[model samples]
Target: MPTFTINGISATVPDGTTILAAAIRIGVEIPHYCYHPKLSIAGNCRMCLVEVEKFPKLQIACNTVVTEGMVVRTDTEKIRKAVTGVLELMLIHHPVDCPICDQAGECGLQNYYMKYGLHKSRYDLEDKVRKKKVQDIGGMIVLDAERCILCSRCIRFLREVSKTCEMEFFQRGDHSEISIFPGRKLDNYYTGNLADICPVGALTNKDFRFKCRVWFLSSFDSVCTGCANGCNVLADFKGDILYRLKPRRNDAVNQTWMCDFGRLEYRKANEARLLVPVLRENGKAAAAAWEGVLSTTALRLRDIADNEGPDAVAVIASPRSSNEELFLAKKLAAEVLKTENIGFTSRTPGDRTSDDFLIKGDKNPNSTGAQLLGITEEGFGRVVKAISDRKIRALLVFGSELSDFPDSQVEALLSNVPFVAQVGTNEGVVSRVANAVLPSASFAERGGTFTNFTGRVQRFSQGFPPRGKAMNEIEILAGLANRMGADWKFDGEASVFRALAASSAPFAGMSYESLGSEGQVVAEGRK
Candidate 1:
């Protein structure tokens, strides 16, 4: 351990900790660029200069490792002068496009200028060097060379993190600017991260460009359900619509990067959503009130369970559902409906589309969670076979579509079943064939836990309300259980999770509050 004093505050930290990191540890703010913790330290940006006791000149805090008895000052007049000089030089040729820039509210250069350099510009606005305004880079990123500060964060991320070396600085001196090769464009699975690390308006996501100001959006810590990796993410929503999904720093899972597929998953929450309940009348699906649909479906299911026996009914749970939703679905089938033909199906397309990075072969995010809840692979096969054999007269599905099953098998199954009730966030093939379609909240609009492929039980909070008449899966299940004469009570996701933890051995001793934003890993044997 090394002892260092940052602004009269003494602290001991491990060796090799940089002065910028040490200052941060002691609540000393050091303005910086090109110093991402996960990316390689490129000390090209001189914004983080700090004064040391015995140093002849200000040292770049990012590359300066702390030493025993080292004293550092970040708020001195000399350091402020140096930082102001650095910012002035960086802003000399930079264009004044803050009014039209997408990163106006969160740009690092704008924030640093307000903090360090609040003086009049020495150069005329007409003298600013003109560069390309908007270049359509591949992989959902737009480049504006005029707003770039040349921090090298995007370049380092492409080279070191994504390993896609498609960009570099061209020319020398003041004329230098970031550009791609003549024929090459920035195209990678993780290319969206370039805009995330750019710090300035130079690089921006094409999908989210000029959609909404960053300050107007409310953010919630959540997890990506694009794959079983369950990468941590921040969901940004405004006016009941999800605007974007950014990767949140979770060193245990996705270090500061997420695949572009997961980053764009928020669009589904805004588009093509199921908003209301529908029921079949005269062979046509029509919108119906929630009370009418729920009461009718409950009566129909009760009749089948009484006359045809519980074995004639089948429940198909989806791997896309959360752990709490899966637990309640299991309880609804086994305890309430008294059916033994309950199982879950995976939505994984194939292993060929998977990569060595965050994208997993298993497309479903909570398959491991479904498995822990006693929903087995063989059980799903048996249920499907029973449906095809015409032994199952009634069917209940959660979040899965008819595409998850074989086309020929599910078509026959759907034709034979007299009553099919489906709950999903989107209107798909299953919902079309189902006699009753109940709209359920999407992952972004619900709060629950998801167990990743490695048995990590991460929890996510609701970012917005469900679309239209859609309800959360937990509430829908609890309503159904109560209608069936069961006394199951659930106020919200937390209460349901507590009850699940109390009943299941794997989830025992775990609570929703205990599973923080970072998540806790369940033991391997339990999985």
Candidate 2:
């Protein structure tokens, strides 16, 4: 460790640790726009200038490596003057559009200006150089050159982190602006990241352009359900409406970034939502209450299991469901329904593409969680075959559309069953063909844990109450099990997870508090 004193506070950091990273370790804030720890240092922004002993001048904290016995002072008057001058230059041609900017509340330039540069403009605002205005860039990003400070965070992120060299600076000096390469668009799987790393309002997401102000949105820690990687994210929503999903740093998993596909999966929670439970009445759908839906579903499931045997009633679980929900589903199948004919979601639609990076071909977020609970995808085919043969007379599907099977084929196969109950977040082919549809809360509205592809269990909090009449999947499953004469009293996700941890050997000694924010990797090999 290299011992150093930053602003008179001592910190001992590892070898080759930069001054900024050392400052972070000691909880000292060294403000900079282009100094993202995950990316290569560009050293273009002088916002992190700090006075160091025995140095002729202030050093940029991002590039300056700490050494043994090194002494650094960041709050000196000399450093303040230097940083104020740098901020003045950065704002010379930058537009004062903070009133309408989406990044206003959380923008680096705006925050830094209030702190350091409150100086009046030397020249007329009208005389400042104007670059391109709101120009539509592909991959769901809208670029506003006038708001750019040329810190190169987005440029560096594209070249270094994403490794997609599609964006570059064009023209000279005041005219220099970020643009995509000719005849090519910024069409990568991780384009949303550019907007996330943009220090200013230059790069903005089109989906979240003017939808809601940052201050008005309530954010909760959540995991991305778009893929098996289970990237951590902040679910921003308000009044039953999910606004957006922003990547939350988890170095063990997504590492400060996530794919654009996962970023846009917030739409599943916001759009085409199933708000109420439904029961088919003579081939037509009718709105149903929780009591009717659960009672009818329980009675039918029991009748099928008793009349046609336990093998005739099948339950299709989903990786999209939480570990608690899956555990209850299995318990419902084995204890209440007394059936071993259980299947799980194998593949999801549009989950076929992948890269060596974060993208996983298996889009289900909790497949590994399902696996840890002894639920495998191998039985899904068998269940489908039974459905086709009309041998499985009753079915309960818990999930969204977490399979790649054709909607028509799913409807055709499900049609053979006399009592099909779909318990899911969205209305799809399975819901359409089901005799009873139970509206279950989406992932954002459910406090649950999703074990990623690597068996890392991460917990996500519920952003808000479920939209309309939809209930948490765990609640629905537990209620139905209780109705079937199985005692299930779960306080919340934690209670069921404790049961899971106790029952599953691989997940032993793990709980929500133990999982924490970064999450814990499961013990290798299962029970």
User: How much is 469 displaced in model 2, in angstroms?
Assistant: 0.7
Tens digits of per-residue lDDT, candidate 1, 225-302, equal 888999999899997899999999889899988988888788778777789999997689889999888887887887
What TM-score would each prediction reach against the true structure? 0.97, 0.97
Write the residue-wise lDDT of candidate 2 on 1-527 in tens digits.
88999878988899999999999889988889988989999899889999889989889999999999999988878888899999988888888889999898989988888888889988787889988888887998998988888888888888887788889889988788888788988867888999999989999999899999889988999999888898999989988888899999999998999988888888899887888989997899999899999999988998889888999999999988888888888889888888888879758776478999899988888888887887778777788888888899999987766368788777777788888898988867777778899998988888988888898989989988899999888888888888878888888999999998988898898987989899989887652
**Which residues of candidate 1, in runs, are more than 4 Å off?**
348-352, 403-412
Task: lDDT for model 1, please.
Answer: 0.87
* Prediction-by-prediction clash tally: 0, 0
lDDT measured at residue 23 in model 1 versus the true structure, 0 to 100: 81
The list of candidate 2 runs beyond 4 A from truth reads none
